[model samples]
Target: MTEPILPRIRPEIAALAPYKQGRQAGPDAFKLSSNENPFDPLPSVVSALQSATPINRYPDAAATRLRERLASRYGVGSDQVHVASGSVAILYQLVQAVASVGDEVIYAWRSFEAYPGLPLVAGATGIPVPLTEDSRHDLDAMADAVTERTRAILVCTPNNPTGPIVTSAEFEAFVARVPADVLIILDEAYAEFVTAEDAVDGLAERVYEQHPNVVVLRTFSKAYGLAGLRVGYAIGHTAVLNAARATGIPLSVTAAAETAALASLDAEAELLQRVAVLVERRTTVIAALRAQGWDVPDSQANFVWLPTGERTDEVAAVFLDADIVVRPFSGDGIRISVGEHESVEKVLQAAQSVVERRQ
Candidate 1:
């Protein structure tokens, strides 16, 4: 019998490795890898989910109600919002909507881990601009990297892995330099944890009002303690929102997730208070880490980064041995999520022991 022939696939798709999430080894272990909110979901949100009926039925395709709520909260019209399973899903859809074969997408290197893959999946070139020495987005360098083929640019404020925000002034100047036709995606997944006075405020509100090509993505996962529920939304010009919505899978977001997200918005004040506590814990941890002579950055997110280089593996191993799971970035650093006081203490103890042993 003749051998069966297989169809050829896109080269980029074949070359990509699956994205690995942070390690969570045991039920008892404190997971400080995913930068998730350590708090439990609000009582009201839980109640809303419990009371949700006919979950067997499909969710609204457009997620009209949740979009309306988000629109009102963000001071935008419902038509300008697009809801999805998560911010990542919205990102993928946005990329697909705008980018095509031979097009280029630019973002800061060592930012969100998912960013590099988004462009690859969309059949576009992924151009990662190296971050500044402080591990912040070098907006001028990113702008200079743009070519005629560039289709989109992604900016992750209070950036992932190394957490520092792009100030409002910096963002304004960068936006002025970019071409209007090139879409700018502002990923604000950690916006709630930011304490910087000059940090970009209501970026979606400002972008949607003034810049037609600017899109802001937000999530209910981080500050809202809804990571498990997986609800996120994007705000942009109505045209761009519609295009992103077009690329999304129908009913990708569940009815229960929508219910929880809506309820979370109602409980926003309480959730933000918890975020404040995490920020305070982050401050304490950073100071302690610096006192111990570790090279750390000024983090604006709910995580701390250690630029451990070749020692990243060692540091992660120490935490794992202490039953604290921290995220280790290859050849870069380790990111430890700020949990509650107890978890933070465990991390501190593990870090102290690791530093002492290394010395």
Candidate 2:
């Protein structure tokens, strides 16, 4: 039976499909559906969370200390750093602050799946530029797509699902073409997993310093294994960030999250060693997939892209039956994350079996 429809709901929001999270696997399966850090929580981080205070009170509204730490690390003032529950939340705030009815937000399609839905809720149109044949962003095409109606542009490095990164040269050139008034967001959620030397590091490169309109979004969720805590930060001009801050859900950040982030910072070295392992696993996955005759993209991030195209669903199911869960963009491809060390052989075995069937 058809569900009853609500009256007077915003048509755009009603039409928008909900953002999908990756599937979870059974206890016997390795869950590689989400690009999550496979390591268990560090002992120090756990201890810090256990030491939280003032459960009766709210968290720091501004996330003052976290912002200050980030600012110092990035060589920016505290005012220039903005922290939110997650980078995705910061994306929503930035979108609502800049785009509205009749405004347009441009980004590469098959990028972050969340990019399209963000503008819809903001009452803005989302323009999705097609990715190139190699599944990398067509920066030139994106620059050409910009118009007076364009309010913001999001560039994802080592882009989600598809693992290619935007080169520093292309990014610099694209920034040159974008109008100064249009807000540009570099969503580097997977920067820590990036091993390619040529890939643009949005925060480390400090693109925001030269372009006042640019903002960089990053999250500890991926590298630090803090997805459950949900903390992320942004670096940009204070004026632009203030606009996002105004749209922010007040006191949404928690003391536990702030403390956890601080503890993660303290444990950065150990966490990065884990990232290095994932990177090696990613390399092995790519090599194995290629040997199986699958044309995997050059993934600098922690995931590999299998452009299964029309076979996406079938291929995903094969992996599922083999006790491995993965994210499949139906009719397009599959995104298999580099997960636990034990999962490596399982993933390759599943992929090889699927490849044999195809052949």
Candidate 3:
């Protein structure tokens, strides 16, 4: 009998647990786990999709037209924009382009879970700097963590998990200290949700004009109500954009996705109005949670974070029992995405019930 043969895999890959997404528990479950737009797609965008045909043909490999549109909007040439399947894909490509085996990539701890994994997958080391006490990115600490072997640093504005933003001044100072060769990726997936005056613009207009090393990542997923469509892009130096494109898989972005993204850009005003509504709801939810004595951080993103620590699981369970799906970060915190009015009310009620029972 031949000995049982098992396929060998990378130790990190074998040890990693699959990423879990928020599940729709039932038909009536109020899902506030994944930070998605609660609004429907704009009529113009919908019509554009309906009009699109020939799904048989492959998508434009370069995403040329879409890149042109983005470039014009951002006041850059076509060479500066690199569209991808989504911002996450662009992020992965960035890691691969800049990081080599044993190089270090630094980012804030608990900002984006994918941050740590992206560098690891590129055969690079990740150095996660701890967040500040107020749950914002500690840019000072992150800048300090950069060393001779550091190749890249990722900063998530209106950061995931905590949702606070890094100020423009803070970001500027941090970038000044980082080595010119080290690429700085400013992941602005939640940029549209921010309303603060000091929030980093993330278009890379100011930063890129002065510092060629900074790259800004944005997506049509959240504000554009195109999460399912999977379209995002990177704005940076033409050189960095070219490097990212070099590592990109051929035909990674589908035709439908490109159509949706272009249409969404045309409907930007309407989508921003919906984002305003979400911001209002986020404010309401955060205030309510704080009133209930929860340690809620000041979030500029579409979601709110409650640092319940070990109680996170229990809180999530309570919401689940109430048919409201929330995301709990094991022993770290619980994140609830702000949704439509009724869904927001349901979350509040479920939270109240849980807190009352605990009291």
Best by TM-score: 2
Candidate 3 C-alpha lDDT tens digits along 1-359 = 99998999889777666667877658888788888888878888888887664678888999987999999988989998999989999999999999988899999988888888887789889899989888999998998898999999999998898999988988888899999999999999999889889988868445876889999999999989899988999888999989999999989888878888888888788888889889988988999888888888889999999887888898889889988888899888988998878887788888888779888
- Evaluated at residue 150, the lDDT of candidate 3 is 98
Ranking by lDDT: 2, 1, 3
Task: Give Cα distance to truth, residue 111, candidate 3, Å.
Answer: 1.3
Q: How do all the candidates rank in terms of TM-score, highest first? A: 2, 3, 1
- Taking all chains together, each candidate's TM-score versus the true structure is 0.96, 0.97, 0.97
Which of the two, 1 or 3, has more lDDT?
1
Clashes of each: 0, 0, 0
**lDDT per model vs. reference:** 0.89, 0.92, 0.88
Better of 2 and 3 by TM-score: 2
Which ranges in model 1 have alpha carbons more than 4 Å from their true place? 1-7
lDDT of 2 by residue, 260-327 (tens): 99999999999999999888888988998899899989998889999999999999999999999999
- lDDT against true structure, model 2: 0.92
Runs with alpha carbons beyond 4 Å of true place in candidate 2: 1-7
Top-lDDT structure, candidate number: 2
